[model samples]
Target chain A: MEFKRLNIVYGHYGTGKTNFTLNCASALAKRGERVTVVDLDIVNPYFRSSDYHEELKRLGIRLIAPISANTTLESPALPADVYSAFSEESGTVFFDVGGDDAGAYALGRYSEQILKSESWQALFVVNKFRSLIALPGDAVSLMREIEAASHVPVTGIVNNSHVAEFTTPEDVLAGYAYAKEVGAFAGLPLAATAVPARFADSLQDKIENIMPVEVLVNLPWNAGK
Target chain B: MSERVLMKGNEALAEAAIRNGCRHFFGYPITPQTELAAYMSKRMPKIGGTYLQAESEIAAANMVLGAASAGVRAMTSSSSPGISLKTEAISYMCGSDLPCLIVNVQRGGPGLGGIQASQADYWQATKAPGHGDLHILVFAPCSVQEMVDLVGKAFALADQYRMPAMILADGMLGQMMEPVVLCEPGEVQMVEKPWAVTGHGGRRPHNIVNSLFLTPDELERTVKERFERYRKIEKTEALAENYMTDDADYVIVSYGACARIAKSAVLAAREKGVKVGLVRPLTLWPFPKQDLIKAAEHAKEFLCVEMSMGQMVDDVRLAISCSRPVSFFGHTGGIIPTPAEILAEIEKMAGGNA
Candidate 1:
């Protein structure tokens, strides 16, 4: 499997969805791969990858949005420039979907073409702790539902199993294993895993080919800290 | 020549943001402000900028914080509930003295209020957004033209003061379609930011971007300094517009969409014997205190008409110090009052029946 196909990370609220996407986007961008991240989560009020627009821009990754004036925070639609970038044979693109199934439903319209286009991998992120859906069976069902709705299949799964500020490499590994089993049963690949950003780099040996989140924030960054 | 184009307030802001050289945006989608986000999504990428519909409003605001810390012009927007969620982040921006733009498309409520327009957020916005003595400069746009012009001003004031500035609008402002001049992309000036965290590449030590106050005294000091900046802002940025106030007997004080409605009321009252004028505030915070006070002296009574029950009425009473009979007539929960309603209120108040 390509280590970095155009990856998509999505799930319900508080499920370590952004943690996974940001880590992957940061890691990919840091590795000198041109990366583009679209913040498509229209529901929930926090914990999204779009919060790192400046950081991504500084890292040489292009950001596409409708924000031109300082006070204009209106998330209109995918700007013409984003499609231009997508049209070019470019680096990895990470589209972060919202937490609720309703938010996920929004992707059905805007991202249908992008999802069906070649080399796009949609990774469904899940955390067992949250009650949106539990058990591998439930996750698979949710994935199938999302795929049917968006006309896009979940290419893989990532287990973000832990409480905020309390997640460890072991928890991540356990979640990864769970995700792998779900992926196997769902007929999708277990693409990757996510360890909290604070886990020391020494823990990198705990899991191979996984993403590491640098920031562990339970709330959205709007609070500035 | 300024061309008139029919466009939504949010789209106008998008066009203005681009014209003003503000190329960064981070936000989650909320009602009444969704058009803004939708517009950004469609335009940002085409112009070599960034747009992301954050997983949540919190994430969207932090994305703005990150971009602002990097010294690039950035913004996040939402309605009242969304702004309530963003208080923690907004407080931090104030504490850090990080210049940024925050747009609150005012909606009704203390909770998940209806999607229609209301200005119930006057207190939360003017009050310290979070726990601090810090003040956020609030700009209230009265029309689509002001939405565009104020966006440019929002960025400039943000950079100049190194403070967070807000465009306090309502759903009416966000959804209204009005004729506006399309500013050429290069004409608007961009603020220079030297304090952005663009990564320390051996040129300087790592710059920590945060808003933590471990010590009370330290936090207090930061707040005091922010207050100093606020005082300076108050002196320079207080803005208001007067309409036919001279020799008028009664004045209508309002802002945002309500102000537009009140303007019509003034004309309607003028057709009658009631000499009514207007004192429309452009900056809701640091409000047009002096002008309101001055207008109160000439006008026998001040009528505060709003979509909300009495949000702006309190501000007028506070500003005028209850010098005149400040009567209020309004509706709450997304009910828009017509100019006729306001004119009736003016007539009643003028007839000494208020």
Candidate 2:
């Protein structure tokens, strides 16, 4: 699958959507493609892309976030720089939307511009391990809710399931099957299956559209690792 | 018996609450604790229970008070700042003598602190959950399985004592994943609340659930009676787990997630021929003072290790009555100390004795 000009990643909490977006942006930047990641997540204060401003800058990727994105202040202040993501003529842009319907509403503000954009894909990320959307039917309902709140229909499904650091290739394969069921229920195509970089080599042959992921977002408790 | 499954600490606590007949859960979303509320939101409706996301932590705690007054198992959970918001309702519950469970997956605090694992709320949870001479039963769990087991125990204690009980956990225990053997919903025995205000039906006198005692003398008598019950709880319900303390010369006092790191340090210190043991407090309120005094009998000195900067050390000193020297080692603001660092501290304490 060709990378679109604009990619919007949406998922339930703990589905690893932020990690997926970061890895995707890092890969595009490494390939000499201009990449800008917009942090549209205001619901979850922790583990957002805005916390990685220094890292993202070093990786040659631009990170546009809310006014006080990673600060202690609970401000809903969306920055004016977010408009740059839509106006940029070059570079791949990624939107890390928040986890729930409330978070997706932020994207609805720019829905008209997103709809008129030349090339864009709103990918619904699914992780079967999360308690909220463990079932295929629940995943479909969540996708519909995100679409309704964002005012942008989901273009594809990305199977990015894992049990945190304990994920194995078998877990990824099982999640791929679960994601396929969710894709069928949502009437969306299976865009990619994100595997941990360690397991990418052995599972690449079996899984199509493999998006090898490097875990970048570390929780404070897991800081030592 | 249900099979063991790998689950996050927050999810396990929620499932255990459900198994313990907790049909009502009211909470506002906060980091490190959002998973517990999310799990309750998903599972409560399926079991014909009430799962409400109140507008604020105060509202959620008040909702728990309402549910508990109706004679049902009710719970509310939040992180540090949110827990602070629920204190007013907690005080009300304590004054009214209502039974309810309050889970605090503590994070760095004082004000709007960082969202990370922390034990800084120890003093707040055990000493002063709310204003007045109020005491709430507090249980601290170190592991995911302990989170499940203690949640069931927390509800039981709440019902048995007819007071608010807190499951004092940190973000590390709330977010980590481990194997847990969940109790079957029907298997666990639940305590019945005979004092519940479930309508008199004209057959009995009307029971009113209120904390207001306008007369100062009447309020004093009620508070004194409550303190008598608290005294009995402190005497009978204090719990602690002692590891390798029999022949050790030094003892380390820790609880919650810090104990997990302390235990590893104890084992490593033992391997290096250091006589160190650990006293892990299971209940913080009815703090196992007697057990610590007994441990101090064999040990020369004590060290209190925590994720905060020496909050629980005062309790350790009070437990031992200043008979032995007490030391403290911790990292404040959500920085967890490594086992190696704790082991080095143990070696230093041991070297001082030599």
Candidate 3:
């Protein structure tokens, strides 16, 4: 029942939030480290922390969710078990919060308690194609909106910039720069930059403040009949 | 050597498919199932495989069919609405007698259902997915380890029967994490697909893998042949897990995510000194008829816990063949019945019978 620093990953829809969290959890759990993922996003049907249950289990990481954590409640509220897990002193815990500003607001209600209870880092994930953030300035404004709604300081940034199968290394680098500027504007660290697996080597030289892609890129391959 | 590790059902499924030689995955983003596609996306490319997030569920399933025709293991996944969109391709694959994996990590359904876990797709998955008398080998994994194991079995059965195979799992199974043993690749005998579209040379005639049989006679023949394969599968592939049923007075029948919740119910019932047991069907298509009938003989009553409005209950009742009174309790459109809720239903049912 030990707790490590709480890592919070959040973003807009299709920003690779769930996938990123899964890979991060996998990397930690593979090393015999105890971790937990809270599936805070009940809104998105596809990309939630719960999807990696089997992988997490394999890695000995406990997953706590509203439904799995508790059997009652009509809406099945996000139980406080995850926060409790984070408050513990040794294990790492990650929260895969929901997409959209509304989803962000859901986290805002509990942000003060989470921030107070644990040494937490909230990374606002940004995919350049998502939201109106084509440039660094636009990203800062959006970050402010997210921060305002969540009422928690956006502690870091992860550049999950990809345009489906068309994402290039250039797009990924631009995401890095965007994260840098956003970090400067928000007085936070640029935690990571999600480069596609194919472009990992190409961006090695270009990336300054970067977190290499732990997960592979999803490209459109011809799945034949 | 297979390595034992913890994995979520969806992640394990992705890994299992890779182990089963599924080299291609086509899917769109959806909750409760994104892990399967995401895991594949991350690993497939590194291992000389293909992973694509298609424009829509329709596109994803068709891409799976395309890969399947090449006689390689291929898969696509989605939640409720997305699964609905992909049914067109599922039916086509059925008609064509193609081998592939169609995973429906079911969420709330009807239309744009909520992201919560659900099991409403029992009928859609077990029944002929498309037009005609087609059959898909439907395997329901209860845990993350089972997810990996079943994906391998799904591929084997699909290839063995020359039909589409489906892991008719729900969001809970897809999203929940559990410890798993990752079966190493190169251990299992990769099924040699001789009828693949690697490329046609002048040495042999070009191969066309399609479901469009122009003549009625040919279509009928295809259906009849497919039925024969299904019958063979029905005989060989039915699997179920029975828990503490040897001295139980009542049995609960369920599958996929529902079965896990039902397991908790059985445990609670036993704790309260009620003689209850569980029969979890691992294969939905074959339906574990013999096992249900066998368990029904000793049990006083059978309760079916499902996430649907009693879809699997029908199959459970059908399987028992009137060995006992069969009852059902469920919540539809992605509403999950809690272990306590299911136990309450069980208590009510058992009381009336007692």
Q: Which candidate is the best by TM-score?
A: 2
lDDT of 2 by residue, B1-354 (tens): 764455778888898999999999999999879989998998999989999999999999999999999889999999999999999999999999999999999888789788877899998999889999999999999888888998888888889989999999988788765656778777777777768899989998888899999999999999999999999999999999999999889999999888878888888889888889999999999999998999989899999999888999989999999999999999975577888788889989998542
TM-score of chain B of 3: 0.94
Which tens-of-lDDT digit does each residue in B1-354 have in candidate 1? Answer: 453444567777877887777789888877788768877887799889999888888888888888889888888889989998898888788878798888999877878877667888877878757776778878989888899989888888889988888999988778654556667776766666566788878998787777888999987887787778778777778899999998788888888877877887788778776788999889987788988878877788888776676767777888888788788887774666777777778877877533
Q: Would you give the TM-score of chain B in model 2?
A: 0.98
- Against the unseen true structure, what C-alpha lDDT does each candidate score? 0.73, 0.88, 0.74
- Of 2 and 3, the candidate ahead on TM-score is 2
Model 2 chain A: ten consecutive residues of lowest lDDT:
A216-225
Q: Evaluate residue B1 in candidate 1 and report its C-alpha lDDT on the 0 to 100 scale.
A: 42
Q: What lDDT score is found at residue B288 in candidate 2?
A: 98
User: Candidate 1: misplaced stretches above 4 Å?
Assistant: A1-225, B204-206, B352-354
Best by DockQ, which number?
2
The sequence of per-residue lDDT tens digits that candidate 2 reaches over residues A1-225 is 457999999987668888899999999999988999999998766667897898899998989998877555667778887888987654899999998888999999989988999999999999877755778999888888888999999999999888776788888898999999999888889999999888798997898999999879864333333
| Tens-digit lDDT track of model 1 for A19-123 | 677667677778788777767665532234555567667887765533421222334344455455355455787777765455677567656566556767788
